[model samples]
Target: MMFEYMDKMVMFQDTPEGLTADMGWLKEAGENGWELVSSVPLIAPNRDGIAYGTVGCQMILKRPKPTQ
Candidate 1:
């Protein structure tokens, strides 16, 4: 069997609405058969070298390869 993979960079504001939008996007992807495999935070360290919040995330998805 073969599979296809996708890597998406999702960004949103640090607010309730932003989070809700993100979840909605994820749910849409799920409905289309994109299985969530991993999610990695994309954060920038502050001047003090401490990471507090994430600006976005990298999502990894996979699905069965389609055949003709």
Candidate 2:
């Protein structure tokens, strides 16, 4: 069996509206047959080289490879 993978980064402003948008993106991916495998928080660094907080998430998805 073969598989294909995709990595999607969804960003947000740490607000309710941002969360809604992110959820929409994930929903769209699911509708396209992409299965969620893992999710990792994405953090942004400050200008002083310090990790502030999570600004988004990195979603890893996989699906069966299509054969031609």
List where candidate 2 sits over 4 angstroms from the true fold: 16-21
Local accuracy of candidate 2 as per-residue lDDT tens digits, 1-68: 79899998877664655553347777787888899999999888999989998888888999888987
The candidate that wins on lDDT is 2
- Which number leads on TM-score? 2
Ten consecutive residues with minimal summed lDDT in candidate 1? 14-23
Report residue 46 deviation for candidate 2 (angstroms): 1.5
Residue range with the least summed lDDT across 10 consecutive positions in model 2: 13-22
lDDT of 2: 0.83
Question: How well does candidate 2 score on lDDT at residue 12?
Answer: 66
TM-score of each: 0.70, 0.76
How well does candidate 1 match the true structure in TM-score terms? 0.70
Candidate 1 residue-wise lDDT, 1-68, digit = tens: 78899999888565755552256777888898899999998887899999967778899999888987
Candidate 1 at residue 18, lDDT? 57
